[model samples]
Target: MEIIRINERPQQVTPRGVKARAVLDVPYINIMNLTLAPGDEVPSHTTPVDVLFHIIEGEGSVTVGPETAKVSAGEIVVSPAGIPHALAANAGTHFSVLVIKTPNPKNMAKSG
Candidate 1:
């Protein structure tokens, strides 16, 4: 058994410019904590694996495919693979989201 603490991980900038930390990285799933400053945006993008975004702090707008909605702490959003999804912090609000991707994309490709 392994244990991981989200706050103990050092945050790093992702290729998309969001501050994030990989709290759990394994073959079957990848878990990350993403922090967005006020007005910061994560441009729309598609993933090869399904993703679940759990809001942990503040408020934001989450766009999944053609749908967009205001989301806040305790809210969870799902984005299926190959669908465009994006997130943005409210005008003066920051956001912390827990991102989970299942079946690791790289492993999926290898198994295909």
Candidate 2:
């Protein structure tokens, strides 16, 4: 059995947000610890793999497709493939998001 620790992976920063510790990855699924600090946002983009984001801590807003909703700790949202989505953190908010991506599609790419 392979054990992956969430705190072991180095944090990476993009123009949009930060990703830390890819906890699990396999042929069919991938999981990661995602964070968007206050005033930070993941720009509107679409991916080929279906994604589910579970807010583990703090408050934020997520725009999925054409809809936007306030999100708080314990809330979860799923974005289907090809749907445009973005996430923004409220002032003073530090959110911990657990992302689950399914299918492990070979064509998965971040929209430029």
Candidate 3:
């Protein structure tokens, strides 16, 4: 078993609008801690791996495929591989998100 401390991980800029910390990355899964402040946006992008997002705090708008929804704390959203997805945080709001990527493709390279 492995354990990770979210606060201890260093943040990395992802997609120009969000900061993320890699929590745990195994052969079959990758977990990250994400934070987006007000006016911050995660640009639309797709990955080969399925992703699940758990909103730990605050509220935001999420665009998944052709649908957009307002998500709040405690909400969860899942996006399948190859679908486009993005997230926008409301002004003055701060949100923490947990992103879980599973069954990562064998061809993808892991970050150093």
Top-scoring candidate (lDDT): 1
Candidate 2 CA-lDDT value: 0.81
lDDT (0-100) at residue 92 of candidate 1?
88
What would the per-residue lDDT of candidate 2 be over residues 1-112, giving only the tens digit for each residue?
A: 8766666777787555475667677777888788888877778898787989899889998888999999999999999988998888888988788878896654244322
Candidate 2's C-alpha runs over 4 A off are 1-4, 15-17, 106-112
Residue-level lDDT of model 1, residues 1-112, one tens digit each, is 8778888899899998999998887789988999999999999999999999999999999999999999999999999999999999998888999989997886787788
Q: Candidate 3, which segments miss by more than 4 Å at Cα? A: 105-112
The C-alpha RMSD in Å for every predicted model, in order, reads 1.2, 3.4, 2.9
lDDT of 3 by residue, 5-104 (tens): 7898998888665799988877888888889988788888888878888898888988889999999999999999989998888888997888888875
Of candidates 2 and 1, the better by lDDT: 1
In model 1, state the lDDT of residue 61: 93
